[model samples]
Target: MVSGHLFHCRKNSWPPEEYVGRTALQLLDLDGGSPPEQAWRRRLNSHANILKEFSVTFMEAMKMMTLGVRLWSYVREEASHGRKAPIDPFTRERCKPSASQGVPLGGMGSGSISRGFRGEFKNWHIIPGLCENSPVMENQFSIFVSRDSGNKKYSSVLAPGHHEGLKKCNDSGISSWDWNLSGQHSTYHALFPRAWTIYDGEPDPDLKISCRQISPFIPHDYKDSSLPASVFVYTLVNTGRDRAKVSLLMTWANSIGGFSHHSGGHFNEPFIGDDGVSGVLLHHKTAKDNPPVTFSIAACETQNVSVTVLPVFGLSGENHVSAKEMWDTMSKDGHFSRENFNAGCSMPSSSGETLCAAVSASTWVEPHGRCTVAFALAWSSPKVKFQKGCTYNRRYTEFYGTSERSSSINLVHDALTKYRLWEEEIEKWQDPILKDEKLPEWYKFTLFNELYFLVAGGTVWTGQDRTLDLNSPASTSC
Candidate 1:
């Protein structure tokens, strides 16, 4: 009894309020189990009406608005983890991404899915490619090369030039796009626009290329915890309508140099690690003997997302060879492995000009299927050792999975499922929530206050006028 008196408070009691009417039990009966969204909203309408009737500070008004928006969301648990439909909702007709019958990728044990002609008509958003996490604000990368501050993280995945991307999409079947969510609800965010880039080269039946952006939400523990690191996610896929198999051979541009400088490649010192992990270490200095700094690209392959990285080399005395030429010559038999000459190559340079090596990776995908490759970029000076390839998977346990890759795949897959389900509801409520025509901004709050009084107690507007009646007849006592 003493311990309880000293340390505990009553769990069943209602918290104290400045203006109170209902008892604890009464309030519990009114707002329990979220019982029917409309019924609950009706309970809050009375105070909302009073607030609407009087002018208040913006901060106070926003608090009320936040409550109303959350009540309107009305999302349930069952819908969030639902299965994904095979076909996308936004596509027009179907996608038959055609490409040249390109030669297989040399020494990478996979063929190339060249950038090709996408079908004549296609929807840019709602295409395939899994994603994780969102980034906003001016970081180091965002400051210099990427000028996408303040916009949604999903928007950054498209070409930096938004207007040109759309025209190219229409005229030559190449498109760029993104997703958006606001007013602070998980389900609503899922309904945001999904944007990606399309590189449709020509109409060939053999190969295809598609790119999509994703801004993943970190688990609460990771987001709130001090992890001391950041993650940037970019996802791409290979899709084909007729065949059931396709391969993607991607030659990464000089990652450190942004996207344009391909000849003086940005990566070197390639190495493979245990599991489906590959990495390259980059280190160089200027002529004046600048201090050496290092950057790394560690590629990880999950079950449905495997990748094979191979080094690119050239003939003796030659600086480098075209990836196309190397692919055609080395993959003549339709297969190759690390035993090939260029398997572990790197640029041999002291002045940082000649012998610049570019690295690439390939993945085999199902036709109309997807392959997500996640790379981590970190800086560790020459004094610090580079992180191993498998480290990326460990850091992103939710994406790479705790036990199996299926669980990780389901994380974003289920989110997309919920978004697709809520798409129609969002359309219905867009105008109402925007405060333009359907309902004035103040009315929704007033309605909320009216219901709030009814549920709390009949104290606000119950009729209690006084009156008395007179009778003429009287009876004798019995």
Candidate 2:
């Protein structure tokens, strides 16, 4: 009979007080026993030996059964909650019973029931809105001073045009500039143009004096799988003489993306000098695979500039797996020991019996020593199924048991026997308990819970309906 503890959690709760010391022989009527009942007794005796080896008591065994019942109830509630009736819940239209069926149970034989497709359509609306009036395309300026001799020693201040000219100059000129002269009388000053200006032939004492301008880019399509999806960066350098410092500030006119929103994309600062030089970095944000968005810069002193862009991408599918589900499954079953867990589990097709897939990615910053900004992207595909005649059963016992027929018979028979045993136990106690002295609230609650569980537990056989079409072709990609 069902254990009393299944009705309540009081101490000494298993097998009911009356059945505590009874032997199998005492509880069974040998004269009226059937083959199935005899087999059950034998199995119970064998299980008892194993339990004894572990020093497990009858009560403990009963607890396991009770726990199983609870789990069954939970599964039922999960399957039924918020579920609409099948298209033909009461009709045998699509889910006719199998030809050899004998009172099928559970969800067996449920025919292909499509759940429909789901996906995120890439919308360029936000991108256009962001790009339309963006202020990133503007050009700006900055300045750096090496010395502060009251601006008297101010010679030829290096400007943005200098870098352009130097790039076109011969090796001798480049070398001469590299060997920049120092001293109050020295006339030659090293100048790196293009966003930087050297004043008084000395590095700015206030390195914080830097400014930026916003410029909107002409709407142009920029596509590249290797480029950053969202952000970009630019660097600036100062080759002045004095210990100059400057504050850098940036401002821009709103454009496609709007300055208020895209303004934060512009970052400027004094360049780090390994041996006494100056520079700054600029970062920009843009849509994936799009052309470089533009912006402007301004500073008290110009510094050599470099640009770097970082990309971002969409989130991958595997990330959707719930943390709680993963944790619980891992805690109960340990890490998935499957040889290819790291390789990735393939996704199963909508109608596949099984699936296999994986997801991964790599990232890097843009070139030219630009801003230190970042972006990322990820993706995943549908599940793929085993090929026809692949015989996956040979590698996975859980799929088909020890051997096809052997495993099938074992599983079906075990389920049937367990169901029969539970039913019998319920029958033995139902009438008496329902009519006996008033039960405590807790006891009533527990008993009803167990009864509901048994009534709704997994079926021994699946009805004629098949929810998935295992015969269909597997998905080509995930």
Candidate 3:
């Protein structure tokens, strides 16, 4: 159950001096509500930054609701056509909906934003708030929830930035739990943290990895905030398996690049199905986004992963600690061989044109064995109709089952269901939250995230667009 999508982001990774005049998002309702939930909570700051639209006024069974988000993200300091940075915060303005009535944040059932968020939220992005004052970067978006009588439902993916699968961001990124919608049985509450700190100084040497979440039950006033994102049963262990891989890269915002793509696992044998699976790899429109925006690479598990999708300055992660120089530069850009050894990542193809929205997942463990990769993501900001020449390399090798890195029309092959369907919907939402409690298998998958109770007071994710004028473009109008 997946469709077209896109990924590509850079523009210096959206950093306007840590984003000016902050405020981003703040909607409330902690089940104790009545003072207008503390008198109308909607702190989406706006003086001239004029990218406004975050009208979320909580209250669940008690009524009164509203969730808006005009949007943000503009960035344009330099790097133009050759791009790696300098514009593409997801241009075109953003305000499109109708794609068969899909994408209001896309949820329900396994809560599929295609395959991205429904609970335990992660470093999500939805096009820098639709930047106007420009200089944006959002980690999470999509939430509609209404209640004057009942009918509008979309519960997950609220305000969660600070990407890189999160580790730490204290300063008020509150997480004692208090999420909103007046908890009837839970609708939204996020704060998954068994520990924190995602990277800062140098890494002098630190990369074994550990990210736990899958815990959710809520009660105790839902916990309420000391930080650690309130907990969600998540696990990412790699103790001694030599060559480990843990990747989740996202950067979307109004796309349509050659039919966007990125899916996960599918190696069915004994009758030959051939869906090929590999780790993260995406390259489109001349390695854009340092500001050119549009990105994807969620390679989490895939037995000794060996995927490819180069061209962003040909990548210089210094071989990210060298796994054979990142598989010999993705096999000397010829796009690997072994005749597509189990290739898979970026599905959906009918060649209809006009697409971009992507997310990925994969798993294959042994050597130490303890695998878990459940990644999901959905997108749609359509209104597209660009002319744009230079789209990409015409496709090369993104784990080649069909050879492509630039344009199998970019990425989007449609989904049927693979990537182990996010651990089969995390064992059907972690077996009814383990029937309540009985923990002790290293804490039984950890849990919590029906908004997990909410109390967060932090999350803007870098900025700096005094309001632009940077010499011209009509003084950065919008």
Candidate 4:
């Protein structure tokens, strides 16, 4: 124990009677005046109680009037009892998140995807202003690595394994996926429209992966920012002596929201877009004469990287063949087997067989070489329909048109093409605040970080209203 001892000291004191309860006139030192002025002051003091009553209720007035005295007496009493005043009950507790969750994945009024700080994709908020908290088991990002021309292999779902088991054993007999990265070795950084995750080769040990996830959440660039899309750019670094064959896999389910699946015209088909971008389109049959909602998962093919697509696969249970087939293909050579694509191209007939799609971008990284792979997830749910009634086109539809005029493939192309401009605008918006020395360091983070709630917090924005010009006589409405 330390040598110093603690002691308590108390002072027994009280204010003089003249100073205890003084009127405004006495406090203002206005008592000394002529006889007429003294009469006027007296009249004003007489109405002081009425004025106080008008300002506050009787109970509040009494509380305010006696607060100092009550505090003094309470402290003296507590001191006499050899104890300090109790801490405020309100301050004894605070609200905190149950897990490490930050940086949502979409833009304002355009829906969003929520990811935990540990790299697990948690909530899917595709429908405008609605959120699904349950995690989609098949909606994930996995990586595959093969070293020395397939002598050694590594593959995982890029997050910690789930505790829950499969719904049931499928005919192919596969049980679960390889969810295998520990949060201890990985780091996630988030600032509004962009987030970065660094995977430090805990299991693979031969290659390191860094993923930068970007959404067009730029300030003042309303058109691109309002689109429901996000991009994932993976940079792979090979540190070993041998060349490593690497594949970055992105798997997403065809499900958007539970409420939108009542009619059941959901389907998936392969699509090869303009810029060597290839993937599948998830078509949903929505209500009204409006065109169906379409979603796409695609990857860009550069000179060194080749893009592969698995149009349809089962999420889990009763289709273990799909999961096993996918895992085996990725693990063996950092690519899917040719037979895995379009083999099980069938529509969902029941609740158990939920359709999911996968896209893989494969490349070979030389010793001490770096490669980058880019993927985009886009959706075009043009019309927002409520449960009971009323339907309106989304704000982004003003720029890209409604479902009849636009598709998710168009979104994918636009997102991949213009994302650089979004980044530039985002940096322009954030640079000054970040560089300012007058602001506290924490405030810099708090400034942009808190804006996530505006977009991800079930926000809904519709088309602008038609304004009438007041200057012209014809513009004025009766």
Candidate 5:
């Protein structure tokens, strides 16, 4: 006969009955009225019957109940804790990404950038084979609107609660901007290589905005996936009675590891590609002849949309003149003045300083009309160096050649031209799995969420060995 608190029989029974093994757990049902208690009783009885059918002993029941109690406590704490979790739109299931990371920007082994679910781009990893997870204070994406009733402008950063800190906008210009959008007005959904954030509600009852960020991460597409680039496609809908003039602004700081130590400082130049793409290139000059790394921010030109670029701007908001100028230009007409468009400013950063560059795309959306504008961010940092004087070439250099030979403009052109085909390939690969009815919903969610590690884990892929074999079939090789 079993002893102790777990093996006690009911008050009326002197000797143990046939269901004695199962009654050990049922004895734990003390509060019969509470919902949690009732549910726990059902689960405990069900588990006890299964154990009794398998000939489980009283001691086994004690151990299993002990573990189950601890698990139940953890679940209660997580569910009843502060703030509810976000829900997936399709599955209507609770979805919260670990560490607040949404789908990242960039291909595998091509240094990626982490864009938080709140829509801020942080965690700079543009250096070849190096991880820089610090958030650059000046990197921002803003939206400006001009409607008939009034004008509305926002920084577009979304968070759960409103921030309370006082920001001196007069002193720092753009640096003092805060996350003004409330969490209830937006929804962020991440499905690996693609993440969508839908913004609606207060601020503008007639405007609905959705941003889809995509990285070229198709299965078995090594060449495209190895390129360092990401595309942001914004779709704006005007649900109001009047037309709306909307502009999307993207700003990035000239940041690398500062390993180059080149003279004459950093600079940016506007480029109008032969394909009609217009943007600016932020050049990090390392060598006198050729810089080691370059960043390109570009937008696709359409019939009714206008694209503008700010070649150079002060990095800090403390530069009152430059910051206010940038903010005012975007706020006024949803466009940057072309007067300083091509003005090449030499920004000397001897003491760990870097300048900023911006590009804007603006257009008018009629009442109940929809419009889409696409932008791309590309980097050309082919040469990778490590500690102890070791150097290697990234896999992307095999096609684009060395850093000296390739430019970020070439990367931008490739990404913009081929990203549609890449998206098609991604849909083709994922459709079957997503449509399957037998697979559990949680299993499908985990499948794509696991792919985040491919890029955000400080991934590095070196060039393949060229001298392995002749141009023969696979059967010919050993």
Candidate 6:
């Protein structure tokens, strides 16, 4: 037994002050038919009695009725515009009531009744087209639905006519079904294949090493056209206790044409450094006495080439091969020609005229052993030029364990030193001209005249005005 009022106030008195003055009170107030005040008072009293019979406090029962009235009032107001509740304060967005409110559970005595009320309430009060289970709705409804509805008398105060249209709308439709709602469901789709290429030994070995294109002549669609061509080298070393005879096998393929070659086991010779990039080496011959120690093949443009090394002899005839060292030896020895290493191919229009080079390296060494290899790729524009007969100009030259260079200060210092030495020599000689402070006035005037003629490079007469009048008509301007 519960007691509560289910009527709505015309306005929420607790709304912020700014909003309080803005919304019309007429819109907020509930018109619970005529006899509104008396009806409400009587309903409230009846709810209190019901709660008292159930051992509930009168204050608790009043609180329940007030809460019910608050919720129902909000519902009625919202149903008029197909809204369940005002937008949440935190989210600042409207939300729908939960569907569980309208779903009846089995074996629950009041479940059906609760669901019926919830259905009527939701269909009439909540905003149309809103998702009820949305995060925002879950947060808001948790605050709205926990209060008791009070006594049935208070609930009856809600206008039946106002909820009639809402109930009809709820009864007309079923919940929308989505296949993706089930966790077990998945969608199958097709996708492009992503493939990778792997190679043995360094892709770009020493500059001297030569690599000839072996397998696929055309590039693969997945491979970049700008990638430079490369080669894979394999070397084998044999270290066996007894005279051993074995055969070696090799396989290769091109990406476009598929695997192109396979070699049967060929007799192997006992060899030490013979198969390695460096070190003292030895070799042995089979009954055929001739051992095939080294082999090389071209690589296709489409696919990367790979090589594997294995000895045919048992433990007593043990042998090791280093693919990296072999490539390094080949590179350092200039096995790869300049033309092969410098393949200046053109780029596509979409790529523009820019040029690029790519170099990759891989090194392998026996455990507990020292090995070194270098790989490099150098590229440049085809339009670049190399100047011939070029001479270098160095400002400084090393002498006496120090740098000697000529600069402005050095020139000035040397010139001043020479001038001082000359002055000393002149003083030592005590020349009359050097000692004389002044010359005769006639001699000074003659010297001045000679300087003037040398500067002007012509003769002229000066009047009292100190202006010169030239004898030649051509010199008049000067």
Judging by lDDT against the true structure, name the best candidate.
4
lDDT of 2 by residue, 1-478 (tens): 1122212233222222222122221222121111111010110101111111124578886877776576566435534752212121222222121111011111111101100000001111122111121112111111222233334221112122222212322232211221121212111100000011112212222211111110111112111111111111112222333322221212122122323323233222222222211112222233233222222111111233221111110112132322223222222332222332222222211221111111111111121111111111101001111222211111112232333223222322222223233334433534455455575533532443333111112111111221222222321100
User: Mind giving the per-residue lDDT tens digits that candidate 5 earns over 49-121?
Assistant: 1112124588987877876576556445534753121211222222122334567788877566787665556
| Candidate that beats the other on TM-score, 4 or 5, i.e. the better one | 4
Candidate 3 lDDT over 1-478, as tens digits, reads 1221111111231133322121111111111110110010111111111222333344541352121121121233323332222223335443221111111121111011211222222222222212121111222221212122223222222223322233333322212111232212111111221111111101101121122222212232121111111111112333232433332222232222211211211111101112332223332221122122223322222354333322121112221212223223232232323333234433322222212222222222333334443322222211111112212210111122223222111222111123233234434654555454554322232222212112111111111212222232322111
The C-alpha TM-scores of every prediction are 0.32, 0.15, 0.23, 0.71, 0.70, 0.11
Name the top TM-score candidate: 4
Full-model lDDT, candidate 3? 0.22
Q: lDDT of each structure?
A: 0.25, 0.21, 0.22, 0.59, 0.59, 0.18
**Candidate 2: lDDT of 173?**
21
lDDT of 4: 0.59
Better of 2 and 5 by TM-score: 5
The order of the candidates by TM-score, greatest first, is 4, 5, 1, 3, 2, 6
- Residue 424, candidate 3: Cα error in Å is 29
Error of 5 at 96 (Å): 17
The clash count for each model shown is 34, 111, 103, 0, 0, 31
Question: Is candidate 2 or 5 superior in lDDT?
Answer: 5
Question: Candidate 5, TM-score vs. the true structure?
Answer: 0.70
Error of 1 at 415 (Å): 20
